[model samples]
Target chain A: MIQFDQVTKRYSGGVEALKNLSFSIDSGEMVFLAGHSGAGKSTLLKLISGLERATSGSVMVSGHNLSKLRGSQLPFVRQHIGVVFQDHKILFDRNVFDNVMLPLDIIGFDRREAARRVRAALDKVGLLGKEKVMPIRLSGGEQQRLCIARAVVHRPAILIADEPSANLDRAYALDIMELFKSFHQVGVTVLISAHDETLMEDYGRRILRLKEGQFTA
Target chain B: MKHYLFLHWQSARTALAKILRQPVGSLLSLAMLSIAMALPLSLYLTVMSIQDWVGKLTQTPQITLFMEQSAETADIAAVSSALKTHPRVKGYTFISKKQALTDLEKRNGLNGLTEGLDGNPLPDAFVVTPASLEPKQLELLQKELSGLPMVEEAQFDASWAKRLYGMVDLGKHLTVFLALALSVALVLITHNTIRMQILARRDEIEVSKLIGATDSFIRRPFLYHALWQGLLAGLVAWGLTAWLIAVANPAIAEFAQLYNERVELRGLSPLELALVLGCAVLLATLGARLAADHHLRRVSAN
Candidate 1:
């Protein structure tokens, strides 16, 4: 569960990224965050993941208040939330298996069991045979899928992706959406931020629209 | 618990891999650190060896009180009584001129040479043993005895001993200062090395942090890498020091032959070697820990 009660986040130098925004999402719900380039979607998601704190109002994830959470407690808050960035933050130095196994490794899964889960996550993303392959060798869509596999590898309760399908073609974008749908169908709460309304409309989920740091709907 | 162990083991394994991945860089770092370590260590070895050599020689400092050749038996008695009551003199043995002449005749071939002499040229003397072996203390005792009436001269053959003691003192101070400076330099070297590794892996570390990795988890591999580097450097320094001692041993033995003294060039003891290696590892670990904590906090702030 996520809640933002009239939260306002202002950057240094008088830049208000999000102003007095209030929203809440229940458990087991898939919500689409529809917004333009500077609509504060990424900022909202960051606040929910405890990466950034609210300036004035309270932001709560589960029962813990994000504003009151100290730096030491952030990791525990983050372990249960999976986040995919727009830039596809994949490690090119290591092979695909190690990349996907990162979250499980963070959570300290056994080596054999972590390898098993990594394979399953990779298989789900349709990159099963490319386990030993380096991330640099993967195509754009494969790399984004690799990011997705990493996010969901630990079975986080809430999955948040920030424009995950940003540079993909229509087909790959649809496949990425379908992957989110599959995870949601398994009762995992999912929130995705995207500019493409049509693609999100195809999934027929609840859409939360934002325009210029304020919720439009 | 099992998972925790596995994570540590995995970090250690990755640390080895990272070091092996860049063999030239790792080897160069090891060489620099070993030389840094060996400079101070070699100095320490030299000081200890000198100490060992000096320790083998007779160091009981004695002061000789020579009586005036014109003095009679009363003068000898005066000087002898003064030496007996002196607090600094632990004991004194008097050698009369007749006894000195007799001892001279007992030498290798000086029997007839001393017999033909008109009178005994040797003065009556007292070989006075001081209570302390310290050069300054013995000098004070000699000075005190030299001012005695009817005393021709008060002598202590400790000039070479004084010089040796001074050199040993200087060596000790130099060794400590050099060790401290090199230890600090080694810490900085390790810190910079780990800082560069962190910079190179900035993306990797950022991603790891985003994926819920704790700071300790992220720092584990870098710490292990520093540890391995320090351990390798220690080993190299030990080997180099041993080789140096080996090369100098024969020369030292030959030099000692001139003095009819057998000197052995021994390297560091087991305890000292352990101390050197332990210091290396501890310094490296401290540097890596500091660097990792600093850089990771900056990365996570974003």
Candidate 2:
């Protein structure tokens, strides 16, 4: 579950990204945050991820007030959540399997168990046989899928993806949306931020649209 | 607990793999650290060897008491007996003024310089060997002997020992200064290397942070990389010092032979070698930690 009670995030030099915005999402609820380029979608996700604190009010994730969370507590808070960035931050220095193994490795899952889970996660994202292949050799959609595999490898309770299909084609974008839906079907609470309004029409899930840092509907 | 051990083992294995992947870069970093460590270690060992050789002289220090020229024969005999009865005196050989002149005349070119003098210019003296070879105790003996009646001056004539002491003191101070400077150099070198590594892997680190990686988890591989670099560099420095001593030993032995002095060339002792290796690892670890902290914080802040 995530809650933002009158949250305000203002960067330095008086740039207020989010101003007194309030929202809440219950457990097992898959919702999409829709906003334009300069909207506060990424800022909202960062606040929930403990990467950035709300400038004024509280942002709570899984019953913990993130503003009050100390630096030492951030890692523990983050362990229950998985985040996917827009840039598809897959490490090319190693193979695809190692990239997907990052989350499980961070959480100290047993090797055999981690390998099994990694393969399972990869299989879910349709990258099962590309384990040993370098990430740079993967196509754009495959790379995005690899990021999804890495995010879900540890089976986090809450998954937040920022622009997961930002630069991909319509088919690739739909594929990524379908991957999020699959995780959502398994009772994983998902929050995906995207600017495209038409993509969410067929999902039939709740959409929280923000226009200039305030919910439009 | 088993999972924890497995995680550490995996991190260590990954660290080694990362190092092996960049063979040239890793080797270059190790060589730089090794040369930095070896230069100071070589100087320190050289100074220690010099101190060791000086320590082996084994001759007890001597004090010479020169009697006043106008002193009477009875006063001279009294001083001689006093020197003989002193507890610290191992032996005393009296040198009369005539014997002193005779010995001076036996030099390379001044055979008859004192032949036509009206009287013997040299005073009666006694070369008294102290039972203690310690410079402090010998100095104390010289002070006590100078207080005796009819003794003009009592002094130590071990000028070579004094010169050696001065040089050794200077060498010791220089070694300390050099050690401090080079240790800082080593830390900075390691810091720069780790900084570069962090910068190169900035994206990976950010992704790891996003995926719930703790700071320690993110830092493990870099720390191990630093540790490996330190260990390899320590070994290289050890080898370099040994090689330097080996290359210089024959010449040193030949020089010592000309002086009819027994000298043995020695490298670092076991304890000292351990110290060098341990300090190398420690400095490098500290450097790596500092760099990692700075860069990781920067990445997380972004």
Candidate 3:
């Protein structure tokens, strides 16, 4: 579960990235964060992920207040929330399996168990056959899929994807959306940030719209 | 705690693998660090060897005594007899005034001038050798000898001894100063290298942090990279020092031979080698930490 109670984030340069924004999502629910560029979508996600502190109000993920969480506790909160980026974020030096295994590795998963989960996650993303392949050798669609597999590899309770379909083709983008739909069907909460109205129309999920640092849904 | 350590090791291993992917850069950094560390370490070893040699050479039985020209044979015999009875006095040679003049004439080629002199001008002297030439005991013996009735002056051949001791003191201070300067330079170089690595991998690092990688998780690989760099550099430094000693050994031996001595150059003992390794590890870890902390903070802040 994620909750934001009138959160505001002001930068030192006098720019307000988020202003008194308030929102909440129930467990196992999939939601879309719709906004134009600089509409505070990224800021909202960052606050939810405990990556940034709210300037004035409170943001809580899984009952841990983001503003009150100490530096040492941020990692524990992060291990429960899977995040994906538009750019795939795969470590180019490692193979597909290793990249997917990263989150598990960070959490100190058992070696044999980590290997099994990594294989299962790759299989889920339709990347099982390409486990040993380097990320650079994969196609753009495959790389993005690998990124998805990496995000879900740890079986996180909630998944956050910031512009997950930004750079992919229509077909690839649709495939990614379907992957998120599958994850949501399996009782995993999902939140995605996107400006593609066409894609949103196809998915038919609840959309939270933002304009000029204020949520307007 | 076991879990933390295992994760740390895994992180370090992953980092090392990544570094191995770029062998050229890693080797270059290692070589540079090794050379930087080797110079001062070699100097330190050389100073230690020289100190040991001086300690050995100064432990010889040698003393000097001056006498008055007015001293009679009876007074001279009395002084010699008294020195002979002392427990520490190993041997004493009485150099009579006539014998001193004859030795001087032989050295200066003035035999005819010495024959024309009415009487022997040189005073009686005692060349005393003590049983033990240990510094403290020798000083005590010199004091006792100087207190004798007929002896004009009692001195030790400690001029060269003083010079050797002074050099040891100077070497110690110089080693400390040089090690400090070199260590600072080493840290800076490693910091710059790590900073460059962070900048090159900026996107990866940012994404890692965004995706819930802890600072320590992100920092682990950089720390490992530093540790490896330090270890490799330490190995190279050790090799460099060994090579330098090999080349300089003959020259040092020649100098020692001229002084009628058999001095050997010493290498790093096991403890010293461990110290060198430890130093390298420390510098690399510090450098990595600085670079990682600085860049990670910047990335997380943004």
Candidate 4:
């Protein structure tokens, strides 16, 4: 569960990314954050993942309070909330399998078990056949799928993506949405920020619209 | 426990693979590490071996008494009887003026060198091995014998023994300073290497951070890198020191033969080897930890 109570995030340059925002995400709800560029969508996801602390309000992630938690405790919270970055953040040096295998390695999963999970996550994203290929050789859509595979490899309770389908074609975009939907079906709380409104329309999940730094009508 | 070992083994392999990918750079770094480590180790061995050899010998300080050339047989006999009765004197050998010249000639094989001399220039001497090697006691005995009739001078080479100990002390200090300086240098080398590695793999680090990798997990491969480097450097240094000693021992033995003794120069003991390797690993690991931790903080803060 993720809860934000009047959370306000102010960057170092005095730009308010989030202002007096309050919201709650239940354990198994799939929500979409809708806004154009500069609409605090990324900041919201960052807060949920414990990547950034709120400037003035409480941000609670899965019973762990982000504001009061120590630095060492942040990783434990993050381990339960997988984050897929907007830029894809896929390691270009490693093959697809190693890229996805990272999260399990961090949590010290059993070796054979981790291998099975890596291949399983790869199979889920339809990248199983390309497990040995370097991420640089993968197409943009396939690379995006690679990021999703890495995010879900550890089977996190909450999965959040920022602009997951921004540059992909319409079909691939829908396919990405279906992937998140499938995870939500398995009782994984999913929150995603996207490039536009129509991409999230068919899902019928709650859409929180933001303008500037506050939620809009 | 099995899982922990596997993780460590994986980390170590990862580190080794990274090093192997750039053979020349890694070899250069290892070469630098070994030379830095070898210098002090070799010096310590040398000083320790010399000290050990010197310690095994007698510590008894001998006092030599030179008699007047004009002294009669009766005066020499009187001095000898006096030394025999002295409680501080353990034993004494009296070399006459004639015997001293002949012995010197025989030792030098210079049968004709003394013929040109008008008479024997060497003095008769008594070498007294004192019962006590104490400096004060030896000094007192020397002074008492110097005042004896027909005794021109009494001498003991106490300063030679003092000089040997002084040199050993100085060698130890030099070795310690070198070791300390080299250890710091090695730490800094490892820090810089790991810092560059972190920068080069910034994407991995940042992605790992977002995906829930802990600070220690991110830091593991780099620590293993340094640990392996340190261990390799230590082993190479030991090998280099051992090789250098083997080459030097023959010359050292030959020199000892000149002194009518045999010396087999010893290398570092097994315990010292373990200690050197342990220190190397510890220092390198510390360097890597500091670098990785500093960068982790800056990366996470952003």
Best-fitting candidate, scored by lDDT: 4
C-alpha lDDT score of every prediction, in listed order? 0.89, 0.88, 0.86, 0.90
Chain B TM-score of predicted candidate 1 relative to the true chain B: 0.77
Model 4 CA lDDT for position B153 = 93
Worst lDDT 10-window in candidate 2 chain A: A102-111
> How many clashes (backbone atoms < 3 Å, residues ≥3 apart in a chain or on different chains) does model 2 have?
0
Top candidate, metric TM-score: 4
Q: Native contacts retained by model 2, as a fraction?
A: 0.71
Number of the top-ranking candidate, with DockQ as the measure: 4
Query: Weakest 10 consecutive residues, lDDT, candidate 4 chain B?
Result: B53-62
Off by over 4 Å in 4: B1-6, B56-58, B112-114, B259-264
DockQ-better candidate, 1 vs 4: 4
Per-prediction TM-score: 0.87, 0.85, 0.84, 0.94
* lDDT by residue for model 4 (B30-138), tens: 8988999999999999989888776655376778999998988999999999999999999999998889999989888899878799999998899999988777888
- For candidate 2, the per-residue lDDT at A194 reads 93
What local lDDT score does residue B11 receive in model 3, on the 0 to 100 scale?
74
- Candidate 3 has which clashing residue pairs, if any? none
Candidate 1 docking quality: incorrect, acceptable, medium or high: medium
Tens-digit lDDT track of model 1 for B44-97:
898888877776553777788888899799888888888788887899899998
Where does model 1 exceed 4 Å of error?
Answer: B1-6, B55-58, B65-151
Tens digits of per-residue lDDT, candidate 1, A16-122, equal 98989888999999999999999899999999988888888999898899899888789888999998888888999999999998888888887788898999999
Candidate 3: tens digits of C-alpha lDDT, residues A92-172: 877998899778877789999999999999999899999999999999889888988989999999999989998888988
Single-chain TM-score of chain A, each candidate:
0.98, 0.98, 0.97, 0.98
List candidate 3 segments past 4 Å from native.
A10-19, A35-39, A91-95, A132-137, A167-171, A201-205, A211-217, B15-23, B66-75, B84-125, B129-153
What is candidate 2's lDDT per residue for B1-302, written digit by digit as tens? 78678877888788888888999999899899999998889888888888887766536567889999998899988998888889988999999998988888875357777767887889999999898877788888989999999899997877577789789889999999999999999899999999999999998898888777889999988888888788789989999999999998899899898887766668988998899989998999899999999988998735
Question: Which parts of model 2 are misplaced by more than 4 Å?
Answer: A167-169, B1-9, B63-83, B92-127, B132-157
